[model samples]
Target: MIPGIIWRVLLIAIALVFAGVQLDREAGKTYPLAASVPEQFRSASQFPMAAMALDSDNPDYTLAEAERLIRRRPLPAEHLRILAQAQFAAGATDESALTIQYAAQRGWREPLAQETMARLAIDAGDMPEAARRYAALFLRRDTQDALLEELGPMVLSEPGGAGRQTLIEIVGGGDRWHNQFLRRGARVMPADAFVEIVSATVANGSRYDCDLLNQLERGLTTRDEAAGEGLKTVIADQCPS
Candidate 1:
């Protein structure tokens, strides 16, 4: 009877050993030998869903959804840029600017964000801010001359004549891009108005460069030959030396 009890105990121990081996083999097969769990997976499972929400077919809906997600998780800088753009699309310029500024402050350094901020500053009538942004952009190594040409007049229009001089200084020479900006500025501004503004700015600042002033005078004259004489007459009367 003792022998029978010992035999039963031995069989039970063997069965347990065999079951342990099977479990170990199953676990080895289920998990890749070199597989590592991702850190993001541990942080939150909702990240992917939040990211996907940004791609909704309707821009407004996507923005709204992203805003909701951002409120919940405070997405990374890239996502924040998207959120800023969404705010811009919703006509919330102030909010968009703030968001983009946050990204910039956080070292995002996205060109699009800088450009958007510059545009926002212009729209907000903050000429100084616009000028600062344009200056920084102009100094960038990768700045596209074509884009600068398109953006120059708009930047110049911010501070009126003073801004025009800055644009001329930045543009320098008869580069095609600079000429394009000059032509665009001329077309958009009335010849008399531009002349008057430039004259006033020149009068106020004694340190103004003669060559730049000459270039502006030439540009104003070439804008519309018919209007040039009239503009000169207006300038002479309104802004006499």
Candidate 2:
């Protein structure tokens, strides 16, 4: 019912609005998601670790907003994690995994991504994948040690007993992580895993197996020895040479 001139004017106005939106969207397709985040997150000094928490009652909505803004501009590693986590909480786990994979493919070197992948694998009931991902993270030079502790619960998902399976996986790396596992991880492990490690180490004939018992003599003499006693007798009696 409008006049032709008015109709033309309205169409032009709508076209201009659409063009503006397109421009905004193109601008946002890399860090500094200024459109979606507050000033603090945009700041170089406060972003990443110090940015605002994305915790929300409607995590799914939050994820959509993040994805929209990220399409306009890529957010930092921390922000990407928030996005992926929201996807996970919203039960969009497959999407969350792909989001993390995209970040990794984009060369994100943060351990948080790796840890998140492992957790996601756990949620999906993929325990061996979880273990493998955790192991990869552990071997990283700057890997967060807390990730190993976090592995405790996920390890419970492993078959052949969580403790034993985790220890087997850890020790399987031989020279690369064997001693590291013994010194940094073995003692505090679940009692069953410790027992399994000790048992395997004493029975090893390689004399250089990944198991910590291969070097039992040194262990028993340490002033700050591990708390487990089962390996003490095995080392003294079996590998006395």
Candidate 3:
């Protein structure tokens, strides 16, 4: 004879599982409505639509979706970041700033939030803040080359020699990005800036790699003869026989 309590528990579990499946089906049907339907008509299942909303060009749709997701799970840093970006794009500057503050507090290591704050810092002429953010981004393999393309010159031109000094510290410490930075710089950076960074790295007590210097010299020479001559002199000065 089956006990009543055991049968009740078994039935409840099966019911809950079926309910979850039903909810998922309903959410799937609602997902396509995210693009065309007004916010009020959207499904209660907001999570399914989050990705589509975030990718949309309309900030209003993104803002609504982010707000809904945040209400459901208030601590997700990604949701907060999307909310912050939507607010910023929608011209709600103060709201955006406050939301990013929350996002940062929740997930300081979140890359999207970091990039948002970094761009805001750049817009505000806060070079040191921008440099700090960019230095963090430089450590990310996927972002390094793109960042160098966009912000390398700005960092190279940082006033009072602080920027160059920062470069020296990174390369001098033999950070893995050191060689990649130099190799990529040979293509993206002004030849003068590239030469100065390499020269400073060697002068700062890091052992010079003659082969790397030779490669850099050849690359710069291919781009600009005068710059190549300049790097040749630096190579002679920094890498002795």
Between prediction 2 and prediction 3, the one with superior TM-score is: 3
Model 2, span 144-170: residue lDDT tens = 556676675566433366434654655
How does model 2 fare in lDDT?
0.56
TM-score of 2: 0.47
**Model 1 lDDT per residue over 89-144, tens place:** 67787888789988655533456666776787778877666655665565554666
- TM-score for each prediction? 0.39, 0.47, 0.67
The best candidate in terms of lDDT = 3
Cα lDDT of model 3 by residue, 1-241, tens digit: 4698899999998997666656655765777644444344444455557656767899888887778877866777767887887788778999999898678557756677667666776677776666566655665666646655677667566533655566556656865566776676687665676677776776676555678878878878988898798788878887767
Q: For residue 99, what is the lDDT in candidate 1?
A: 90
User: Which model, 2 or 3, shows the larger lDDT?
Assistant: 3
lDDT of 3: 0.69
Q: Each candidate's lDDT (Cα)? A: 0.56, 0.56, 0.69
**Per-candidate RMSD vs. true structure?**
14.5, 10.4, 5.7
Pitting candidate 1 against candidate 2, the one with the higher TM-score is: 2
- Taking all chains together, the TM-score of candidate 3 against the true structure is 0.67
Clashing residue pairs in candidate 1, if any?
none
Local error of candidate 1 at 116, Å?
1.8
